[model samples]
Target: MRSHLLNDTTAEQYRRSVTEGVERVAAKIAATERPFTGVTVDALAPRIDGIDLDQPLYDTTAVLDELEEVYFRDAIYFHHPRYLAHLNCPVVIPAVLGEAVLSAVNSSLDTWDQSAGGTLIERKLIDWTTARIGLGPAADGVFTSGGTQSNLQALLLAREEAKPGRDGLEGPASLARLRIFASEVSHFSVKKSAKLLGLGEDAVVSVPVDTDKRMQTLALARELERCVTAGLIPMAVVATAGTTDFGSIDPLPEIAELCERYGTWMHVDAAYGCGLLASVRHRDRIDGIERADSVTVDYHKSFFQPVSSSAVLVRDAATLRHATYHAEYLNPRRMVQERIPNQVDKSLQTTRRFDALKLWMTLRTMGADGIGRLFDEVCDLAAEGWRLLAADPRFDVVVEPSLSTLVFRCIPAAVTDPAEIDRANLYARKALFASGDAVVAGTKVGARQYLKFTLLNPETTTDDIAAVLDLIAGHAEQYLGESLDRAS
Candidate 1:
């Protein structure tokens, strides 16, 4: 039937398939009553494993019917208000439309000829973001998969820049002396990137954080001085614009001054706080970001866009040439000589998806200000949730949020034993997830178990927070009671 090819004969079939698929998705979204359906891995795995791929259904309806039972029935819905889990956002509608178009067209954004208009669109969006970040005229960037890749690329550039002048003995000996500094609370990707870059685990030095969980600049200055005395090269100082667990933003202005003084590269991981670029009122939070050598921004995390919307911006555009590779068949030296705008020249990837269209459509439909307001809404909700947690006396709310995440653990006044409280909090989180009424996240701080409420949904109200808090408290008390019964 040549159904795979999208020619004139298969055009009607394509339209019908899209209509049916979207209808099913819409129905699923509308019918989802909970954030999760509480289906365990053991129960779901067998159903999926039982599907005989050799036996083809040969009909889209039959395939979708099987998918409904195996996948859609228990899928977690991030759009639901009760989903106070991860950094997943309920995406804006325009981005969803962009996804449909990009998927059908299947544009590859590596070379100029393959993309053309797609390349220009991505460049324009990068320019817009750079302007918003105030990275100056020489600033340039490229869209990446997410923050991890962006951070890796940023550190790679820093390592290349940190190379010692050749004196006939500059191979492994000099590379071993290179060190990267980051706050203890910074993303784990920093250490992982160091290892991938052949620097090993010892190359990363963790700087201490203050009581507010922000990196202490004075300690950082001291570390830099120590590095100079020890004949170690400080390759990069990675500052966190938003930490995952605490949502605390390190003091960037002070850190930037330290990096300048030490002649070290500054890389700001603004994956979670990049929404401030659009924030009219709170943009000052990332004031020193423009001074950074490089910055990582994940629009997917905070811009109300779907997954895979992120970019790595560099202050001096020439720095991106560090990632450039001349491929014979793709972005060759001849293309560079011709001044062709091949995005692959600045990317760590070859066959990249046109993920920028999602952000472009989102910015066009809901202007930058609209996304900022949505971000502000969630921050406001976090404040309310914090107040509720603080007043209830059941939860030991960690600190006031700098963004939309609250890290706290259940600790009723009656539960005096610290160990028991920790166990109870852990038990409560699992019980809530197993019940499937709501979904929340968990983390640990200083060997103590903590429950996290990453409020990314602006639609999630104080009422929803209260309901989840009630569930947490109930489960905690029940767990404690059960433990006491077992003890007796």
Candidate 2:
């Protein structure tokens, strides 16, 4: 056990074990032919369940060999060029190396003592992100596990700020009257945050979106007025810079104005669109993001970093006080007086991982412009995909992508039944998944099933998009034929 520990005495053992593990994973990646094996739970679960955790494999190689049967074989390989499903990006080598170093060090990011340079690195990264979003000099933030946490923290601050009379929303009576405004297509996190904050499900007022799937500013303004007229407090207006299904960015500048007029907090959930901040050609797409009182960015989604790398930034650094708590032994009040920078002061979490190191390494290795080019490639690929879908007679595209996602559905000309068309599209996605050839996401646009291509891999080319479309069409056509046979 001591030999396995990563101490100076066991440095050689640590190097050997980690190197073996890395090589094993590298080999599996190199050999993976598809994004996944389309593995079924029934088949794989039994193998995992059969493992006896009480028994230990004395050797690392033996443990890795055992892992091959359960974990590695069927794992989804996002690095594959054909992996067009979801917002999972192919991580850069630099980020992966950073992951290795950080995991070995295992620094807790909550306090300065636990993470010395780590705290500063995270602050620097937060500063870099806020600067990119034009959050101004007084802006400050802390890294979160992901977008959901970031959104939650942002809304929590909004709730606190909405409290009036210096005592704050003062009581539960005021909490009951608080409301959040968001577009119908905004991330579900907005509503989830409302619930976690003790607001009712109805607290999230769903404003309508325009033809491009963007939140209609007029509708948002009307909602804000209605809330005030009814004596309800408009806590916050969540403006999504990139909707998951359609990649539609709401009208940010207009939303910001509405928030100001209503004296509400404006939060831009740019988890998906934050990549545009690094984009060489498309930075102007999210022009009004700067006006947000708080912004949520998921580097995992767009910056090609690993999972769990995200930040919630604010225009006023003081607003983070809503999440702050001073512990006697941890972040004591005296620490603030001492001018110590503590990440736990701004985070909802305690004892968080040093996830900022990955982004730091990525920036140091490739620079932001390198990330911009990678993100731009994916966005460009999505445009080409949209063109292909628009030209194809068999599919209907919902909207042009604002980032790197395309939502479209296969509509068979022979099928007049909308429900049947929906079934064909659904069947195509499932069959393709079961076959382990390609993976795509499914969503409903106006109660109709649609196939989605969330292009996050830069290596995924236009030709791959065309190929996936052909596969989807074939599966859909096959399903239509099967339905006809069954009907006959």
The ten-residue window of minimal lDDT in model 1 covers 164-173
Give the distance in Å from residue 152's predicted Cα in candidate 2 to where it truly belongs.
0.3
Pairs in clash, predicted candidate 2: 163-169
**lDDT at residue 254 of model 1 (Cα atoms):** 96
After TM-score superposition, the amount by which residue 472's alpha carbon in candidate 1 deviates from its true location, in angstroms, is 0.4
lDDT of 1 by residue, 263-331 (tens): 999999999999999986788888899899999999999998888899999999998989999989887
State, as a TM-score between 0 and 1, how close model 2 is to the true structure.
0.98
Candidate 2 worst ten-residue window by lDDT = 164-173
TM-score against native, each model: 0.98, 0.98
